[model samples]
Target chain A: MTTITVATRPTEAPAGHRLRFMFADMITVTWRNLLALTRIPEALFFTTLQPIMFVLLFRYVFGGAIPIPGGIPYVDYMMPGIFVQAVMFGAVGTSVGLAEDLQKGLIERFRALPMARSAVLAGRTTADAVRNVFVVLIMTGVAFAVGFRINTTVVDYVLGAALLVAFAYSMSWGFAAIGLAAPNSETAQVMAFPILIPLTFASTAFVPIQALPGWLQVFARHQPVSVVINGARSLMVGGYYHSTSSLWYALLWIAALLIVLVPLGVWRYRKTS
Target chain B: MGANSSIAVDAHDLVKVFPRGHVRALDGVSLEVEAGTILGLLGPNGAGKTTAVRILSTIIGPDSGHATILGHDVVKEADTVRRIIGLAGQNAAVDDYLTGRENIRMVGRLSHMSWKSVGARADELLETFGLTDAGNRVLKTYSGGMRRRLDLAAALVAQPPILFLDEPTTGLDPQSRQDLWRVIEGLVAEGTTVLLTTQYLEEADRLARDIVVIDHGRVIAQGTPAQLKADLGTSVVSVTLADAGTAQRAAVLLAPLSAQPPLVEGATVDLTVDDGPKVAVEVLRSLDSAALSLAGLALREPSLDDVFLTLTGHKAEVANDGGTPA
Candidate 1:
């Protein structure tokens, strides 16, 4: 019989110590995923490339065809909307990443480890949130280059950027649910696009509420995406539509998205193999 | 070797009915691995081997019954169980985008090791798995064998007392499989209890101390590899008859000398008998006396294939270097 070697086996850490490790482990998972982003330049290139193309298409192609109220530059009005759309697209990456992990059996390995169960979702969402922040900063630079100037103070701009990032963070939880539900990365993209496309296009992100047909205008005005867009626009441009309630509505939608999607995502993650 | 030795891995009556198509992947399966010993769960594909490993490792919950690793319950004390057990699943779980070293370090950090220790351990494992040269290369650039080795290294980052390897060499070439087998042997020598699942009988024969043959979601036989092979107790005599009409009469003529009832397939009759050559000669003479011509006749030593054929009424799905039964 082989002699037992106490030194070879890992002793269990105490409960209190393990709780601290959970956060640390979550950060490690997040860092690993971010490192993956650096390695996959193609995915990042395509992701950012699509949004930049949208900005150029709307600026040169559609800008001449449309006019905003109060003689405001369309560039000024559309920048915030572009930022909102860019962050929303960034959130879809969370689901695709998570689904890809599941398909590759990486999640099964993680689940088998003693790390915090929340770390998988936490790390994925956090990584995607950081990516959203990066995307927003880059889009902001592009907007400026194309003559999109902020009419508000520096504090308002920072807060608007922060709000956009927070909204993307909230959206990550929803997409995390989709990722856990999808069987593979391709399926995750297919599943996300339908929901995301409608939520983004039917809102005021690209066009004013008046430009849409009356039936679509109702959706464009009241949707969460529209609320976030309005909140961001008012914060950046500071106009008649800039009300404190717009930010409150965006925050409320964020709270609702988290309260519902976080638990659903965690539940689905627990149920997956 | 004694009965008082601690059970490192204990599972009782595990049942898993998958939601999709309601396939009953596992039904009432149970086994035990004594401390510092290996238990090979051997079976054909879709025989509930992966399901059992997943349930034991807490990836999926069993429909009923329970399991424990290193005295911690797999379900109730899963966190503790996770702390003590390491698992390398069917698919290599290393991140394709990360370097081999980074993948190991990632798992080490997730296991709650300090950053310094994570780096140290990653280097140690990279050396041990012969991955030092490729340590800085991303996994997508690594060979299939290297990826699997890195995955196994990831599982060992914490040096858990018990390890589960689910078909570690499933898709590997023969040379890679041998390299992995050596690494596993090294780990076992360091006093780790292992539960390995594989379709290769030769793998179980080489590595397992005790073997459990499972089929159709249940354990069909259990013993040491030698014991399982020895229980067959005789060779198989297969006789191909020239007179198809006389095959049944030939089987009746050989019944008393055969250990089991003769099995007839097409024009051939297979009999399990002691003293295979003598039995083959006697059967040939008897069939000739009965005016039944013989097309071909042979007596062969029993192999694991015969053992599988006897237990499951079919051959194992894997292609293995067939070893003659002793």
Candidate 2:
């Protein structure tokens, strides 16, 4: 009964055809984001540039004042801490950009498209992870330039880098979820502060956990930020890798964050009524 | 793709209540659209046009209605329904950062076209929408009309059987509106069924083959333009003048010719008169006696606006673009 005058139009489909359509659509969304970012290479520059500057600044400016246990240099100790923050904060940029998209009604347009429900977020998180890798590499190079040498063998360094990148990649999902759930950009910033500040300051990101107050020390030791920094730092310091407990802790955080944020983000998307 | 289905879109008593019973956005509204013709949905603000469009497009669910787009259920089979329907909103749903070509290509990709096919379709749409020259330029630099055209082009990327236009020309200039109307005509000529919603009377008159007139979330009347106009009781004789009291005196003279009482509104005088042309001349003779400046006179059949005024005792609010949606 379809009186379609055109001879080359599709009229009916099966279930698998639609599922593949969603997958293909997500790949396009990912490419669209990357293409949009190509013009503003500044995000790439800032992500890398800001982290490099911080590592150098903290090393030359305050390295002499702060003493470390076992006399490990501040440059060597502070590099991993700054690296994690730089990458995590890099994710907040994606969150803010997501907030901007919401205001502009871009997200609504995507929802109207019968694409993969999670593809948009997945594409963003994937691209962000790549950005974090480049940013972390810059931070790592600068750390080495400032007399912060990795005492561990080459294999350990690779393992540590892999862990850090994985951690950063996983973190973007939470931030992406926040960007979608946040009512407005200002609220997004407000919400980010409480989550980032407590996680960053309470953990052994900048200093060792034993250096904090009694109540904070307990929290500092168990927090995900502490586990991540210790894990990355342990790989660089060959002597600390004997236990490898920090690596497991970091992985636990990654798994835990993915389980909580990904579904919540997807659920929020479904309710986009 | 239900290109083979005779019924492009069929719905029954679709009702959608937003924010519980306190707000009834769409109250028991339903209509069907045959394949290949443009079915224009005309109503003033809050007429449930957008709500019905949303329900049919599968963007939101109807509380008590069932709809099938090309044989796919709007709710239960949303993915299938979406595959056959394309929607372009009053506000341009485009990403400004991307180029027109890139935006359309992205939509093609989302619709599952291969990258090569996506790029090819993007170019085709860009040329058809008169945006080929601006294809490479970012949408941020495009004019308002170009952005809207590109938005429409993006919606058509999937080649959906049914197109949903929700006030497609709300803010466009006269020239741009005409351009969109042409594009819509082209769509229908190529066998695409359209469910267009608009608040502009002229747009509905120009585009809709069959008009569905809605008010306060219900269809007041549904018919062809001529049929709807004929249902307005009697022809209206409208007169425009340059000087004072011409319309007043004309109303007095035209009173006896009217099936209903004559009405004098501002500078123009209108009367729902029988055999309006015969009565229009009589009105002019009275105005000539007043020695008032004679500007112009128009005697014509009643329009949808007049029908709206006659039925509701007032025109529907023009700007019913509330924050709520169907």
Candidate 3:
């Protein structure tokens, strides 16, 4: 009997030895999603193409109609907001991907494995963040070609881009929760728009805060999306609207969202069918 | 050996009710699989087969009761049990965007294998499952059979001592199912304890040493294939007449030799008999004396279908949708 037990026993790790395993599992899952992105060029094409279209449509088509409040070019003024908007859209892709995995029963497969429970959600959001970074870089290049310039120092521009990516990464957790709650990817995509429309459209992403009605102006200026967009906009192109305090407020928003949504996503994932 | 040590999978009175509508997926289900043996969980669609597998594999917790794999509690020691079990779900849960080799490697890495050995094991599995030629192709481009094979390969990459397969061949072509059965046989030969849930009676008969049949979230019957058939007392005799018109008359003639009345369908007369060959010979002699020209005559042992029908009071195929027969 002892021999049978010895022969069949699974390899046991030392007490509390799973910390490194958790990191490894997370990285492996991240690597898998990233590999998938590379293999499916269409996913990359569509993700990159949408931002390019936004840059073009907002810059050329809506650029003439939209007025710049700070005497700045509409293109430069809108680029920060566009970057935040593009990154937000990119983050929604996380929800879609997660919902697709759930619908396809991939999550059940992951659950049957012995790896870290947090690895699947962590890896998914991390992969989308990495993809968001790439989209931001490509959009930056496109902005540069279209006469969009960073008026501030290079460090500030880099900081602004980093904050945008971080915000996008934080938002991915909220999307993860939505994905786990949603029945399918199509519903996730459709349902995300309602929540996103008020955030992006009502904020300072497209037009100036002054363009909105007086009642909506309060929310338009004070909302987290506006704070982050205005914060990134200040760091990239210095203007009277560039307030240093907004950056801290944006960071606080990102941190608060991560604190709330990470647990919610993981909890939802564990309870998912 | 102690009882727990001898039993690889020991589940007791597991009960799971879905929270939303309170759907009773498992109602006091219990069973055990001995070490290094095969146990087939037989059921129809929605008979809680997948739910039972999920609970035993620790993918989902049971609402009540307990289960253990290799003496490690599925809920309390889920991580340890997970390390020792491999599961191939009904959907063949391999990622579509990954190549067969990459899929195997990913599972190996998740199992905490070193990168070098993971690579080697991936190659070896790809070869073993006959996916070496298509190893580099993304799974979306592979055939359904190829994807199912890849899923099985991924599950086996870590060589877990216990395996749970939930309808592993549900959507597979016949040849692919045969190939998978052969691979599974090889795994059992290597001393892996397997608990497979399948709707196909033949699958259970061919692979499982012990079979447990569940329906409507309860165990309807369980035993070895032969024992189950004998318990049904369903040995049968069939005689085909040269004339379809004579079948009814033959049924009347054969009724006295059978335990129940004979059934005539087209040119054949079927008799429910206890001693098949003896009754078959008796029926033939009577039919010949009556000048009923015989085209064929045979005695047949009871099949799993008869056992299922007798126990459930309905044919297995009829009550197979996990509900009362339509």
- TM-score, one value per model: 0.91, 0.87, 0.92
lDDT accuracy of residue B309 in candidate 3: 54
* CAPRI-style class, candidate 3: acceptable
* Least accurate 10 contiguous residues by lDDT in model 2 chain B: B317-326
What TM-score does model 3 score on chain A? 0.94
Estimate every model's Cα lDDT from 0 to 1: 0.85, 0.75, 0.85
lDDT of 2 by residue, A1-273 (tens): 111232224445555665566566666777877777776788678767766776766777866776667557777778778888887887776676677677776676676667776787877777677667777777777777888788878788777777777877776777776787788777775777778878876877777676788988888888877788888888866574334777788889888977887787677667765
Q: Candidate 3 chain A: worst 10 consecutive residues by lDDT?
A: A1-10
Q: Where's the lowest-lDDT run of ten residues in candidate 1 chain B?
A: B317-326
Q: Considering only chain A, what is the TM-score of each predicted structure?
A: 0.94, 0.88, 0.94
- Native contacts, share recovered per candidate: 0.57, 0.37, 0.47
How far off is residue B192 in model 1, in Å?
A: 0.9
**lDDT tens digits, residue span B247-297, model 2:** 676667657766666656667877766577788788778767766667888
lDDT of 1 by residue, B178-264 (tens): 888888887888789899998887788889999999998999999988778678757889888866566777788888877667766
DockQ numbers for every candidate?
A: 0.50, 0.33, 0.41
Model 1 clash pairs?
A: none
CAPRI verdict (incorrect, acceptable, medium, high) for model 2: acceptable
Off by over 4 Å in 3: A1-7, B20-22, B239-271, B281-297, B313-326
Candidate 3 lDDT over residue span A50-160, tens digit each: 778988999999999998788888999889888988888888988999998888888888888888999999999999999988988889899999999889999999999
